[model samples]
Target: MTALTERTEVRPSSPSARSPLGFAGLIVLLVLTTLFVIGLAVSFGSVRIPVGDVWAIVVNRMLPGVFDVWWSQARESIVVGSRLPRALTAATVGAALALSGAVAQLVTRNPLADPYLLGVSSGAGFGVVIVTVLGFGAGMLGVFTVPVAAFVGAMVPLFLSLAIGGRYPQPTAIILVGVALAQVFSALITFSLLVLADERQLGSVMHWLAGGFGDARWSTMIFPVSALATVGTAMLWSARRIDVLQTGDDGAAALGMNVPRFRIVHLLGVSLLAGAAVSVAGGIGFIGLLVPHLAGYVVGIRAARLLPVAALLGAVAMVGADTAARSISSSLEVPVGVVTALVGAPLFVWMLQRRYRRAER
Candidate 1:
């Protein structure tokens, strides 16, 4: 047995060959895919522009000297001023949530986990309700109040869950505690909406809860993009530790890793990603839960490879969902969250069934 183990170790498969691409290739592909998807998403809406026109608009704006003759004020306004920012925001938020979910699942070692499973979304919703329903949007103070309230709301449940679940020991117990806190916060949100908000105010509150890209202004995109870049960089840097942790806590510790410290750092990063996403997107669901799992199944369970692939899949999913939400009805645009749920529910079930079948086999 000792000789066999030594032989296996000596002939161990190269990690580079296993992934079929270096880190540079992965990054370049991710960037190209992101740009392509963003362009596709921007060109599509209630009023569809031809693919040629889409590229024309993008090239004319991005490379004026190269495509100066293709410039048009009307097209640029429609694409650049309106659709481009919204599409980019959607991609960034989707990628952030998916990556956060991936990291959260790794840190918690819970198959059923998601970034916002710890009551983060509920907290953000509660914050938005307090600001919008209380008639605070018109004031100068209200400018930063919504996001501030959301940040506080997100952190509250995270710390509360940690406190209730005890120290960094049992992942299952921690997950259960998070679920309980989520339920409590969700109930609070419902009660506030029902008791404090009037009928007129309730309409706006419901709209926000349903989630849409309609609010994806330049100002709103700043925070989400900034948060995504920062948290994503941290996650990427810690990817190898995540892979080690997947081998079990004892295995990770035996390999000279500080398991507890790694978990804390990953948890904090995911929380920041989740909070910022919830603040901007207003509780878009299923992306975090579904995207990471899908990426794992498609690529592999290794967190390092799964991270960028999950981000791409998430961007594609959200951009497609948002397009459907806008184009589904001529008279009204459906909420992007509703569209995601409609599509994601069946896909999620299919994935679970496949996993079960594989396990049985």
Candidate 2:
């Protein structure tokens, strides 16, 4: 049979099984759910807006003149200026984290790997601490200092990892180095908090480390979304090469793929994506590790197909988690990172159990 016929035969036949419609349907459901969650999530917090008012605010801003007759300026400012940016920031950051995780797993061939496994998050944290303690993130300089420090922190480890690894470095070795560096950075962060930071500064650092979108502003949204768009586009362009690389280096070499070049390109892409994410979001965890696995189970392991679906799922997961973080308690707003760990740890254990059972069979 021809290649076309072979391809056709390999695919499932039933519309339910074969057509991407089901996946498309899931994407649609996820999008709607994300919108609802954002609406509900915005209506929550210390000052609550009723659901109806929240919806009206969103509609008036989004649709402009269509709802101008009934629009309230105060409500519009709350939803459009405050909550909307935070919600979108949460969604975008989550998607970037998830996509980064998926790429790391594929590149390393390790199930446990996430964006933080490379020391990126810890490094960024250290950078932020340094700026904060040194008094650079104060007075007139505070606005731009944190993100600049964070970006530097993220880049250091990424470049170091690439340098230390040389050609064809083992994935396990890279992760080991990352863990060590992360520990070292964490110690520095603790030292800074103890020695230099005042109580208020320490409190601010602690809060940032915990991770939330409460500080998110329209300006904060610009960098990450721009980075995601550019880097995500690059990843999609090279999706076929990434898929080939998944079949083992030797297998990829045999297929005439330049394994090293492919690896470097993709790693750089992930570093840029992860670094940008850390610069803004302050190391929210697990969206990357959990979302990709969930997406793969739903959409199969084909990298080309998996990338976009995983991104969408990641966005859904992040938005949902952010909503839960704020609404779970009346008096306390839970950290986004903590919420993600709560959900991810249990899911990971379940996945491990399932894998072990499959192995036993």
Tens-place lDDT digits, model 2, residues 141-169: 45556777888888887677667754445
lDDT of 1 by residue, 1-361 (tens): 0000110111112345134565557657767877777777777866667667887777766777665555467766888789988888898889988998888766766656678866778877777777777655534444456666666677787778667765757544445666677777788879988999889878877887787787777777877789888889878888888888877778889999987767766776787788888777778888988998887755566777788888887887787788788889988989999998898889989998997798799
Off by over 4 Å in 2: 1-21, 46-56, 137-142, 167-175
TM-score of 1: 0.87
Question: lDDT (CA) for every model shown?
Answer: 0.75, 0.74
Q: How many pairs of residues in model 2 come into backbone collision?
A: 1
As a whole number from 0 to 100, the lDDT of residue 1 in candidate 2 is: 4
Q: What lDDT score goes with residue 334 in model 1?
A: 96
Question: Lowest-scoring 10 consecutive residues by lDDT in candidate 1?
Answer: 1-10
TM-score of every candidate relative to the true structure: 0.87, 0.88
Clashing pairs in 2: 98-288
